[model samples]
Target: MIIDVLKNIARFLILSLLQVLVISHVPLGSHFVLLPYVLFILMLPFETPKIIVLFASFVLGLTMDAFYDTGGMHAAACVLMGFSRTHILKLISPREGYDNVMKPTVQYMGKTWFSTYALILIFIHHFVFFYLEVFGFSEFFSTLLRALGSTLATFVFIYIVQFLFYRNDKISI
Candidate 1:
């Protein structure tokens, strides 16, 4: 129990630093913002309480907002994503229904399932974030395009992080 908590804490710090110091500077054009920080929220344990998730997400977003000078946009989007996480999990739940898994990872859930789950949540996060940043409908098409592009870019980075940093520990006997 304590180990899991420590692991999550470490993950949060690592991802936060990566977002603020590294990914934020890797310019991918105007429309594509890389929010790999969302991966920290998405990779949280399945059994984590809803309130805890929201709090953690809010803190994470606020940290980003402090760095990016986006005011509360990241916080709002992250909170919404955290709020919607439970429903999304229920929506995409497998027949077995998460009885064995603690965390949702590509290794545990398989590529197809993890990809679908990550893509949907990331899209929600990016869509809300971009819309809030733009703050109006005058540039609706551009905002939508930016959200979609950022979602794709962020998804790619998250996937790479999962593959490279997180290893499959389950052994086949």
Candidate 2:
């Protein structure tokens, strides 16, 4: 139990730092934003309580907001992503349901399931984030396009990270 908590804490710090110091400055151009930080929320164990997830999500977003000076935009989007996580899990859950220890990772869930899962959550995160950043529907289609493009980029990066870090199979290298 304590080990899991420690691991999660490490994950949060590493991912958040990666977002602020690395990915944030990658210059993906105006349309595509990469937010691998969202994976921190997505990869939480299935049994985590909703409130904890929400709190963590808020803290993660606030950290990003602190760095980006985006006010509360990231916080709002992350909170919404945390809020919708369980529902999305349920929506994509197997007929037999999930194992208690199962995590939402490509290694455990397979590429297709993980891809589907990540895509939806990333889209939700990106859409809410970009829209809130813009704060209006003035350029509705452009906002949608930005959200979609960012979603795709974020999804790809998240999956690659998951596969590289969490995959059970040993690579020969």
Candidate 3:
């Protein structure tokens, strides 16, 4: 139990640092990339409780907001993503079954499942975030264009990173 706690804490800190770095360094057009943070959320163990997940999401977003001076936009979008995570999991659940040991990854879930899952969550995060930041639909088309472009850029960046960095081991789902 203690080891698990320590590992999770370490994971949180590392992910937080990565998020900050990605947000500060990477540019998707006019906005800093936020998709790596979504990957952080997705990388959490399947058994993590919704409340804890939501809280972590909020903290992650708040941290980014602090860096960007965006008040609570990132926090709101992250909280929303956390709120919808369980539903998304249900939607993309494995065909055979899922063990408690399961982790979200392309190998564990398959590329199709992983891509679909990431795309949906990324779109949700970017749409809410960009829209809220702009605070208007008066420029509906432009806002959507920005949102879509950023989402694609973020998704591609994260996907390539994951592919290069992580190795997959087959486990029973």
Q: How many residue pairs clash in each candidate?
A: 0, 0, 1
lDDT of 3 by residue, 22-129 (tens): 555665457434456677777767888889889988988898788779999999999998888878988878776567766677777778888888888888888999
Error of 2 at 104 (Å): 0.9
> Comparing candidate 2 with candidate 3, which one achieves the higher TM-score?
2
lDDT of 2 by residue, 91-172 (tens): 9998889986667777777778988888998899999999999999999999999999999999989878876887664333
Can you give the lDDT of residue 45 in candidate 1? 91
Kindly report which residue pairs in candidate 2 clash with one another. none
Q: RMSD in angstroms, all models?
A: 1.3, 2.7, 2.3
Model with the higher TM-score, candidate 1 or 2: 1
Angstrom error of the Cα, residue 159, model 3: value is: 1.3
lDDT of 1 by residue, 1-173 (tens): 67888999999999899888988889789888899999989988998888999999999999889989999999999999999998999999989788644468887787898999999999999999998998988899999999999999999988988888668654342
Off by over 4 Å in 3: 1-5, 31-34, 168-173
| Candidate lDDT values, in order | 0.89, 0.89, 0.78
List where candidate 1 sits over 4 angstroms from the true fold.
171-173
* Candidate 2: 10-residue stretch with minimal lDDT: 164-173
